[model samples]
Target: MLDTDTIGYLAATFTTTAFIPQAWLTWKTRRAEGVSLMMYSIFVVGIALWLLYGLLSHAWPVVVANVITLMLASFILLMKIVYK
Candidate 1:
C-alpha cells in the first residue's frame, strides 16, 4: 500500500518549491509587470484556504507547504503593488 504521508510530503514540497523561484525573482526584481495580480490574489487566497483545511485535518504536508507558499505569494503580491 502507498504511504499517504510520504506522498503528501513529497508532492507538497515539490509544488511549493517550484513556486519559490518565481516568488523570489519577483521579490528580488520588484518587477511584476508581466505577472497577473488578479491571478496571484486568487491563488494566494486558495492556498490560504488549503492551509486552513490542512490545519483542520491535521495534515502536516499540506500545512507546511501552504504556509510557506502563502508567505511567498503574499510577498510577491505586495511587491507587485508596491513596485508598481
Candidate 2:
C-alpha cells in the first residue's frame, strides 16, 4: 500500500504533469491567442496561494507541484501577453 506522502506525490505528479503539454505547445508555437488571459491570471494567483499553503503545512508534494504549476501557468500567461 502506498503511504500518504507517496499518494500525495502521485497526485501531485499527475496534476502538475498534466500542464506540461500546454506549456510546451505554447512555448513552441508562440501562439496563445486561444488562451484566456483572465483565466490564467486567476490561475497563477491561485497556484501561488496553494504554494504558500503547502509551505505552511509542510506538504512537500503540494509545494513542489504548486511551484512547477505556478511556473507553467505564469509562462502561459506571459505567452498570452506577448502574443496578444
Candidate 3:
C-alpha cells in the first residue's frame, strides 16, 4: 500500500501535470482569447497562497506541486495579459 506522502505525491503529479497540455497549446498558438484573465489572475493568487501554506506546513508534496503549478499558471497568466 502507498503511504500518505506517496499518495499525496501521486495526486500532486496528476494535478500539476494536467495543466501542461493547455499551457502548451496556449504557448504554441500564442493566443489566449479563450482564457479568462480574471479567472487566471485569481487562480495564480490562490496557487501562491497554497505554495506559502505548503512551505509553512513543511509539506513537500504540496510545495513541489505548487511550485511547478505556480510557474505554469503564472506563465499562462502572463500570456493572457500579453496576448490580450
Candidate 4:
C-alpha cells in the first residue's frame, strides 16, 4: 500500500510538473490578452494559502508544489496586471 506522504509526493509532482511547461510558455510568449486578472489573482491567493498550510503541515511535496505554483501563478498575475 502506498503511504500518505508518498501519495502526496506523487500527486504534488504531477500537479506541479504539469504547470511548468505552461509557465514556461507564458513566460516566453508574454501573452495575457486572453487571461483574466481576477481569476489569476484569486488563484495566486489560494496557492499562497496552500503554501502556508503546506509549511505548517511540514509536507515537503505540498510545500514544493505550492512554491512552484505560486511562482507561476504570480507571474501570470503580474502579466495580467502589466498587459491589461
Candidate 5:
C-alpha cells in the first residue's frame, strides 16, 4: 500500500499537471480572452496562501504542488493582465 505522503504526492502531481495544458495553450496562443482576469487574480492569491500554509505545516506534497501550481497560475494570471 502506498504511504499517506506518497498518496498525497500522487494527488498533487495529477492536479498540478492537469493545469499545464491550459497554461501552455494560453502561453502559446498568447491570448487570454477566454480567461477571466478576476478569477485568475483570486486563484493566484489563493494558491499563494496555500503555499504559505504548506510551508508552515511542513507538508512536502502541499509545498511542492502549490509551488508549481502557484508558478503556473501566476503565469496565467500575468498573461490575463497583459493580454487584457
Candidate 6:
C-alpha cells in the first residue's frame, strides 16, 4: 500500500506539472487572448488558499504543488493583463 506521503507526492507531481505546457506556451507566445481573466483570478486565489491549508497541515507536497501552480497561474494572469 502507498503511504500518504507517497500518494501526496504523486498527486502533487501530476497536478502541478499539468500546468507546465500552458504556461510555457503562454510565455513563449506572449499571447493570452483565449485565457479567461476571471477564471485565472479565481484560480490563483484558490491556489493561495490551498497553499495556506497545506502549510497549516504540514503537507509538503500540497505546499510545494500549490506554490509552483500559483506561480504558473500568476504568470498566466499577468500575461492576460499585460497582453490584453
Top model by TM-score, which number? 3
Winner on lDDT between 1 and 3 is 3
Position 39, candidate 4: lDDT: 84
**How high is the lDDT of residue 9 in model 2?**
92
Candidate No. with top lDDT: 3
Per-residue C-alpha lDDT of model 6 across residues 2-84, encoded as one tens digit per residue = 99989998999899889889899999999999899999999999999999999999989899999999999999999999999
TM-score result, candidate 1? 0.91
Tens-digit lDDT track of model 1 for 1-84: 669989988898899888788878987787889878999899999999999999999999899989988988898888888888
Candidates, ranked, TM-score: 3, 2, 5, 6, 1, 4
Task: List the lowest-lDDT window of 10 residues for candidate 2.
Answer: 27-36
Worst lDDT 10-window in candidate 5: 75-84
* Model 1, total clashes: 0
All candidates: TM-score: 0.91, 0.96, 0.97, 0.84, 0.96, 0.95
- Which whole-number lDDT from 0 to 100 does residue 47 have in model 6? 100
After best superposition, candidate 1 residue 67: deviation in angstroms?
0.5
Candidate 2: lDDT over CA atoms? 0.93
Question: Candidate 3's residue-wise lDDT over 6-83, tens digit each?
Answer: 998999999999889879999999999988999999999999999999999999999999999999999999999999
Candidate 2 regions off by >4 Å? none
Q: Rate the local accuracy (lDDT) of all candidates.
A: 0.88, 0.93, 0.94, 0.83, 0.92, 0.94
Candidate 4, residue 66: how far the Cα is off, in Å? 0.6
A best-first ranking of the candidates according to their lDDT comes to 3, 6, 2, 5, 1, 4
Candidate 4: worst-modelled 10 consecutive residues by lDDT: 18-27
